[model samples]
Target chain A: MAGETVTLSSLVTWLSRFRDLVTENRNYLTELDSAIGDADHGANMARGMAAVMEKVGASPATTADELFKSVGMTLVTSVGGASGPLYGTFFLRFGMTAGAVSEFDGAALSAALRAGLGGVVARGKPELGDKTMFDAMSPALEAFDASVASGGSPAAAAAAAYDAAVVGRDATTPLVARKGRASYLGERSAGHLDPGATSTAFLFQALAESLAQG
Target chain B: MKKLINSPDHVLADALVGVELAHPELKVDHTNRIIYRGEPTKPGKVALISGGGSGHEPLHGGFVGFGMLDAACAGEVFTSPTPDQMQEATKVADSGAGVLHIVKNYTGDVMNFEMAAEMAEAETGVRVESVVTNDDVAVEDSTWTAGRRGVGVTVLLEKIVGAAAEEGRDLAAVASLARTVNAQGRSMGMALTSCTVPSAGKPTFELPDDMMEMGVGIHGEPGRHRVPLAPAADIAQQLVEPILHDLDFSGAPTIVMLNGMGGTPLIELYLMYGEVAKILQKSGIQVARSLVGNYITSLDMAGCSVTVLRADDELLRLWDAPVNTAGLRWGV
Candidate 1:
């Protein structure tokens, strides 16, 4: 399955599964946020994903770029917090990099993931030990790139990314937050898992599961 | 959980209904969730716009009227407004003299407003300038953090800079005045109780009856430390000492505001103000103008914040300018 590609339908499936994941874990995500930041990350992500589903349901996009762009815009308009702009930027930049492609081979999908990570960095400016989504996403993208470079299939690359994301997410629990509202806690922000990193890990998990099933 | 709101989902929309009924002088755009001055934009006045999460009442929204904010965009409770809403407000409020965006220092507000300003200028060619207020001295300035949180000083900055814009100052002048006000002002807040977000349906934090959170942000985020509850006089000292330490308020006429978080009562606010005023007097700080009440507030968080602005004759004159708005009205 080396150089295996993911179709537009697979991307849609991944998003649908992600929507469900967020909806199921809304309370958990918000609970994580309560410890350090404002307790609304779960609700915000759920609301944004609901809006994304509605928008895509009404006008389905044929190309990968168009679909992701619609998802990004919906989140930007509806989410209303730091997550909204950060996740919105990720998908928006991903769409721009994909540029109307109908499917993504392992290499092409890796590039798109890299572009999304770039967008998050540009918007949030989180450092490696900042305990933000960047902690998870930065490593996940690197793992994906390495897997693809070794001629892995899309599923194999996504699995590599997912494993790296979990490690990154767990690493955030002991570090002091260096960005966003959580930074207000200073030393107090430690001992809690970063909500953004947790959600980002879920994203890669959804990607891996979807590609594996395909 | 036990709020006057109908449901967690309808809080913002339903509140707008009340705002429309309460203030006939303002126009409510339900679709975009923006509140505008009822009066049309003047031909040459530089428009002032500010907005943030909805829970901070009478702020950005209630201040929308003559000699204040020309438009205010409302986001969800404790959430920053989107760029599209801000871009729309910017275009509608601009009257050929450009527009000034008064933003708070929160990461979300800063990023969204920055995006809106770029979009407004790129799409419509309307000149736009922005000033982000980072007046909360509670959050220490560090290389790793997002700087200070914008707090009570925002209320003072909006009023002063809004008056400057109303005087027909251009965008550059108004933006410059806004920055100066932010530079001269400092704020510190403390919370007695944490407020619950409707969606979360629980208090953001639990402060025991014997303890209080110091240096709290408007959203009820934990402050610098938690100390045992103290008398109003002691609380005033705790809040005032930080502002004074952060900046030298002596040798200048100052405007002081003792603002309550929403759940705090007026009587308690007045008592707090008396204590704060006494401290300022002893410190050789001349209180040229004073405001006390729930001007900017957290949603039902029982707390108070103090703001001190080192003012001059010009700012005092601007403070005395005629202004009429739902949240604040005097000299009208």
Candidate 2:
């Protein structure tokens, strides 16, 4: 079971788990934002993910492409912030790369996630140490690719990605933000964990939880 | 938070209800959270559209009327409105003439407006031009960042560009004017207290009674640095010096706005303006015109922002032209 390919059911579970994580850590994310950015990241993410789940529940998708496209569009409409577009684009690109498949093997999962990372970069133009969600997502995707390259299972790759995501999220605390609203604070932006990076860590955590449940 | 509303979740909706009730000249699309002028967009005249987060009252919505925006999309407080809402507004406001999107320079706002423009263009082949206003000097100016926050100059731009659009200028002329207004203007804001977002249920940040935030953002984003509370004169100097440094205002006739950030009273704003006037005069900058009030605001954050727009005869004429809106009325 641990080495099984990811199914559409697991993808649904991943989204559901991510919603729970965002809802639980809503205040924590907003608190981090209040230090150096606007204090709406938590509420935005929770609301966006909830809307995604609701839409997915009402009209279920049979393939990975259909599922993520719906998720992306729902987030783009419901969440009205930088996160909405950035994260929405990520899922949209993931879906585009995932094609109309009933299941995803380790390599397919890695390729889909890499496409997602590319989407974030294209939309936000984030770089290393910019203290955005990209800071967590970039390393996490790299770890995902690394694990798959070593002939690991999808579950193992997810766990590796989550660990790397946590490390990347932690690394953002000491960075002076050079993007988004936090960049307005200049040097004062240091010593605060980026809200975007922290939420992204939850994303990897949700993926790990869903795949590890196998 | 102790706000006058039904609930935190219904704040934007509830506020839109009030906007609908109070102003019959403007039509509120409750489904899309957009406010449009009761009258349709003229057949040949270019239409103007602008919007952002909702907490800043009487901004995009209040400015929808005879000589201002044709439609305004409303988002949640301190959040950019979604692309669908904007695209709807764009389609509704577009006539045979094109529509111009006047966006503020926030990451969310720019991205959302950009998406709206693309969607509208693809669907209806409507010509759409977007002008992003980034006049706030409080932010760091680096290619790496999102640049400055759009603050007070937006109000001035709406008035000036709206009149030009009313005069039957094409989309290119109107958009060029909007860009000129943005490039020639500069703003700086300082907060005496933190504004509470209704959903957050608490102040965004804490500040001691004896301290204040300089270079503060409209959404209570902390500014360049916190400093001890100073007298109005010193604060005015802090505000004016930075703007003056960012742009040379002395070479041209200027239109100045001393705007409130919601909580500050009229007396205090006038007092602050007095100090600002003295500095401008001492600096040998000729101020051709001035407005003092809570035009663009942050909710319940007691502070003021100053905007200086360099103007020529054509711009001053546009500024003086007939206008009618919930927020600003002149020459009507």
Candidate 3:
């Protein structure tokens, strides 16, 4: 989903699917957060997504870009915590980069996703291996780009991105945090995969799953 | 789970209802989950807004009034408020002068505030400036990380900066003062027991009867370390030493707040404050002003936090200025 479709409908569907995955894993995410964060990442994201679905349910966006922008605004206001803005910025920039395109070639989608990743980096100021969502997202985007360059379809590229996200998420367990609340734990922050990165992996997985449905 | 409540889901909303009913001076925007002063933003005056999770009561909400915040957005217990809520608060609180956002240094709080500022700027053309409070000395400040947690200094910063805004200061002045207040303050907290959020239906963390967690933040997240329970004097040293070590508090007249982390009795807090004061006196630190009680709190965590703000003459003046609000009311 990250590098697959630049259209507004595809983006909306992607966000809707992301919302579902977050809601389902809310408790699991919260459990991980209890180890390193305030124990609200799961609940916060669940509630934020619930709001997103509710807000977008009745009047679905006619365009993929509109849908992404709408979801971005909802997350910014509904998510409340750091995830809201970081994730919201991701989609806001994605929507802006993709503009009003109704559909996109693989290259267009790849560029939009890269642009979104750039937004997350700019806002979170996280570098590689900081045990942030960036850890998962950066690798996933790279995989998507590589897959598309190798002539994979949107669905196959999404699956590749999802695989990269999972690996990145798992990799966070051994890394020390240099950002967010977990960073406060210092060396003690090791031994726990970041709840943010884990949940972000779900975002890519959901995208792949949803695109398969389409 | 045995706590009194209609349902776990209704805790925050029901409590907010209770707040609006009990405090007529405060207005509740249940739709956006914001609690604010009922009065309109004063014309030509900069507006101040602060918010975080709900369990820390009288905070963003209690601090909203004449000499403090014009709006306080409330999120679920111990969760940061959403950006949209902040954006709405900014719009309503803005009086054509500008809006000052006082945010805690939590990742969620910082990001949400940033998004809200961006939204307000794009949609309403409201000039918004924010001061991030990171005065807690428990976490080491380094090149890599969000730095220290923002704790008790938040309460003091709001009051002092709120005064600056009340004086018809511009947004930049208000924001600058807020930042100065944050830089000059340091806080350290400890918890005897982990508090339970109503939704969670259990304590946030476990604590043995013989031990206490030191360097606790307002959230019930575990502290720097857990140590055996000590006497009031020893506990006072344990809390104050980190603060003293983190920053220089000597030679300046300081305002000290010995705050209870909810569920602690005033009797205990006053006793703790006595020990803290004696220790400060021995360390040659002058206490120009002090407040003892639950100013900022973790939900039902039986513990206390210490905050020392190195106040200048101007800050002292603002500290004593008239403030009419539900939480802090002074010279009318």
Candidate 4:
């Protein structure tokens, strides 16, 4: 399944699942944000993902890259915050990495996820444990890489990535943020999960569910 | 929770509508959420644009007039506007002369404005230069963490740069003045109460009446520390001392502003300013000019900020220059 062909419907389905996950957990995400940020992360992500689902569902693209690119541009335009740019850049870069492919298997998916992580790093500059979205996303990508290299199916690889993301998200609760608005809280930022990381975990969970359903 | 509004959700839209109604001199762009002078963009004058979340009133909006901002983009309450909104504003404000962006150094605001500038330059060849104000001394930036938050000095930078632009100074000169104003000014704020975002329908943070948050940001983000409530004079000292220590205002004539954070009253701001002035006098600093009012604000946050700009003859002259807007009007 090295060069498996994926369809635009798969992309739309994944984003729909992601949006639902965010909507269901909006309160929990906002609570996480309340501890360190302005407490709007959960709501902002939910709104963004809901908009993503609506836009993608309305006019389904044929190619995987085109589908992801639409999601990326929509997020960038509609989100209107730091998360919009960061997350939007992730999808945009991921689509570019996919190179207009119709489908790819576990290894190719891992490469695309790696490319998305790189885009986030380039934009946010968060390190391994900066208590940002990168904390969760970086590890999730690594877990996907490991699982794919070990010949795990895409579903199994996504499940591993989701687990890694949850761990990384919880790790932020003890670590003080060194980036974004939470950094202004200094020592006070501890004892709260980074909002970005929490939402990132949701993204991975959505991916896992989408893979299983597909 | 109490506000003078048709509905909490409609505050920004209503306010923009009211602006158009009350001031026929200003042109309100309902679609893009920008406020500009009624007259078209001046042919050769450098355009000045500043904006952020909607809660910081009189700023970005009230500052748009003959001698202040050419345009102001209004975002949702406590949320920065998108790059598209800012790009549209830049295009509208730019004639043949380049445009200058007076941006607050918040992460979202900076990123959006930078994106707008990039887009504006690419689309229309408008030489867009930006000056970011980061005068808040609450946050420490070591090898770790984002740098200090931009706070009150944004108002001062807009006024000075706007004056320069009104004087028909070239874009380069206006940009230079804007940077100088940013470098010379320092501000610190404290909150007696947290602000409630209209959309959130609750306070951003809760504070007991017995305590106050020192070094509070305009957006209701918690500050450097929380301390027991003190007298207005003492609060003034706490806010001014840090700013004075961070920068040298000695031997330099300073323009001081004791700005009320929305919910704060003018009487309280004046009282705070009196104490701030006494401290500045004791420090052997000369105050050339001073303003005390709710110039920049958070949404109904009961607090005030102290901004001290080291003014030269040039800045002083510009400060004296006429400015006619909804929030501030003098010598017009």
Per-residue CA lDDT of model 1 for A24-118, tens digit only, reads 99999988988888788898889989999999999999997899999988888888778888999999999999988888898889888889988
TM-score of each: 0.99, 0.99, 0.94, 0.95
Chain A TM-score for each candidate, in the given order? 0.98, 0.99, 0.94, 0.95
Candidate 3 has which clashing residue pairs, if any? A8-A63, A8-A64, A8-A65, A9-A64, A77-B84, A80-B82, A81-B108, A82-B108
Report, in order, each candidate's fnat.
0.60, 0.63, 0.62, 0.39
**lDDT for predicted candidate 1 compared with the true structure:** 0.91
| DockQ scores for all predicted structures | 0.76, 0.77, 0.59, 0.55
User: Which regions of candidate 2 are displaced past 4 Å?
Assistant: none
Which digits, one per residue and each the tens of the lDDT, describe model 3 over residues A1-214? 2444444555567778888888888778887877777778888788888888887886787765787788778887777778888888888898788777778777777888888898898889999899999999999999999989999877777889999999999999999889988887677678998999998899899778766665
Query: Candidate order by lDDT, highest to lowest?
Result: 2, 1, 3, 4
- lDDT, residue B310, candidate 2: 91
State which candidate, 2 or 3, has the greater DockQ. Answer: 2
On a 0 to 100 scale, what is the lDDT of residue B79 in model 1? 88
- Which pairs of residues collide in model 4? A6-A103
Candidate 1's residue-wise lDDT over B112-226, tens digit each? 8888898999999989999999898888765668889988888888888889988898888899999999999999999999989899999988999999999888876888799
lDDT score for residue A196 of model 2: 96
Interface RMSD of each: 0.9, 0.9, 1.5, 1.7
Candidate 3's displacement at residue B163, Å, is 2.5
